[model samples]
Target chain A: MNEILADIERWRSAGQRIAVARIVDIEGSGPRDPGAAMAVNNLGEVAGSVSGGCVEGAVVLEALELLEGQRDAGITSFGFSDDEAFSVGLTCGGTIHLFIEELNW
Target chain B: MSSIYESYRDALQAEEPVVLATVIEGKNVGSKLLVFGNENIEGSLGSSELDRVVSRDALGMLEAGTSEVRHYGVDGEARQDDLSVFIETHSRSPQMIIFGAVDFTRALAAQSKLLGFRVTVCDAREVFVTRRRFPMADELVVDWPDRLLERIGGDLGQRDAVCVLTHDAKFDVPALLSSLATSVGYLGAMGSRLTHEKRVDRLRSEGVTEEQLSRIMSPLGLDIGGRTPEETAVSIVAEIIAIRTGRAAPRLSETTGHIH
Candidate 1:
């Protein structure tokens, strides 16, 4: 969140609704630890990151869904350990669990 | 902007040592309690009792600069897993105090800053210990290393580092002597094998125990065969990481087939 403070401030000033994805837990060799965050505005702009580029795209998609009111604030796990082989996964083979939510609070 | 977020941003941006405890896997998920330094921070994690217990634990996490999920029962009972609170600690950046403003001092200071350490270059010689020489350093102290350590040593902890680059016995002895009195995690010195051998005897004479001497990584840095100052700086910081993480510094040729 510290890394994206500037962007969040900019988007907020412009009255852009934002959604944030925070890594709540990581298993095995994750490039980033818990609390790594990424924010996405309603316009699809991104700020910060929750992984080493491998999962940011997927996180952005989840954040966008939240912004679009397609989902409620909840947990979304991604990694090699997931059943979907074709899904976005970390190259390092680590699992990361993210809590996706709107910045309404 | 939400008042809670405004206060959180203000405390965190100032590097005032704050913690944000969030309920990620429990009832009332997304609830937040912002704990900053000893004050009853804004927001709460459900109940007042839960806030009190989490605040105490958050302070401990803040001091250690670690982020992790801790389990607790509703209302914060001791031996239960009804809730999981993510305690994210935003500690002030760890400090790296480099004694002696030499060529290595300049390179090391730059490297330390890159690694997010608040660098302080200390030397008795005012001429060398100028801001122009070490512009990257957060602080330029024109004082003996012992005096500087005496003032701020108590605050030093496991995340902090002290590097004594001044091989001169006059400076090195007092520097090591006073540094031993602090809880600073990493104590390293710059020198060759011969210089370290001599330093051991001098430090022993000055009453530094063998146990204390063991903590000092004399002849600092991994044996990366780095000749240039910049390369040596990389090796030194790598060594510091290895020391903190307890990873084996495997030289390529010396290691068995496996690199992992």
Candidate 2:
């Protein structure tokens, strides 16, 4: 989050809506620890990263969906361990739980 | 009046400790509360009782410099999964204090900053400790390493590091003695095997116990065969990470199990 603050402020001051996705939990061999964050603006620009390249593209999509009101703010899990057939999985075989929501607060 | 995020941004920019608690599960998702180091709070978790309890726990997490998801009842009761709050702490960054303002100190300071450490370069010679020499260091102290440690030793903890790059006995002896008294997790000295043996004898003569002496990672850094300052810095920080993670400093291709 500290790394992306500058971009977040720039986008926010420009009157662009933004969504934030934060890794709430990780299991097994996770590349990044919990509290890792990524922010995506309405324009699809991104800041920071929740995973080591893996799952970040999917996280951006989730953030965009949240911004579009396509889903409520909630926890989304991505990993091969899940039975939900998550196409995007971490190469390190780690399950990451991300909480996606708008940056209104 | 500032919003919760404004307060959080200001606190973070000022390097003041703060924690932001957000509800990720249960009622009122996205509700946030900014818990400052002074116990002051802004915003709410939709319930005053819940806010009170979460604020208390957030303070504890802030002290530990950790972030994680916690479960609680609607009113913040323990052992209840009615609500899940993500407590993200922004503590003061960990510190790396180098006792020699030499070429290695410059490289080490830059490398430590890359690893998110607040680097401080200290030396007894005012000529050696200068901002021009070490622009990456967060602080430059022109004083004996022992004297500087005496003022800040109590604040050192398991996440902090102290490296005595000054190979001279007059400088490194007092530095090692004072560093031994601190709780710093990584206490290393840069030297060869012969120098370390001599230094160990000096420390023992000064009444440092075998156990206390064991804490020092003399002949510092991994066996990376690095001789240059830049390469030595990489080896040193890698050793620090290996120490913190309790890894044996083996190459991933040669080892099994988790690579993280």
Top-TM-score candidate index = 1
Per-residue lDDT for B1-260 in model 1, tens only? Answer: 46777887888788788888888888998898999886567798899999999999999888888888899999999789988988888899999999999999999999999999999999999999888899899999999999999899999999999999999888998999999999998989999989989998999988888899999998999988998889888989999998887778887587654222
TM-score of chain A of each: 0.92, 0.92
Model 2 agreement with the true structure over B19-136: per-residue lDDT tens digits: 9999999999999999999999999998899999999999999878889999999998999999999999998899999998888999999999999999999998999998899988
- For model 2, the stretches where C-alpha displacement exceeds 4 angstroms are A81-86
Top-lDDT structure, candidate number: 2
Provide the clashing-pair count of each candidate structure. Answer: 0, 0
- lDDT of model 2 at position B238: 94
The per-candidate TM-score of the B chain, in the order shown, comes to: 0.95, 0.95
Candidate 2 global CA lDDT score:
0.92
Q: Relative to the true structure, how large is the alpha-carbon lDDT of every model? A: 0.88, 0.92
Interface RMSD of the candidates, in order:
3.1, 1.0
**Candidate 1 displacement at residue B163 in angstroms:** 0.4
The best candidate by DockQ is 2
Model 2, C-alpha of A19: deviation from truth (Å) = 0.7
* DockQ of prediction 1: 0.48
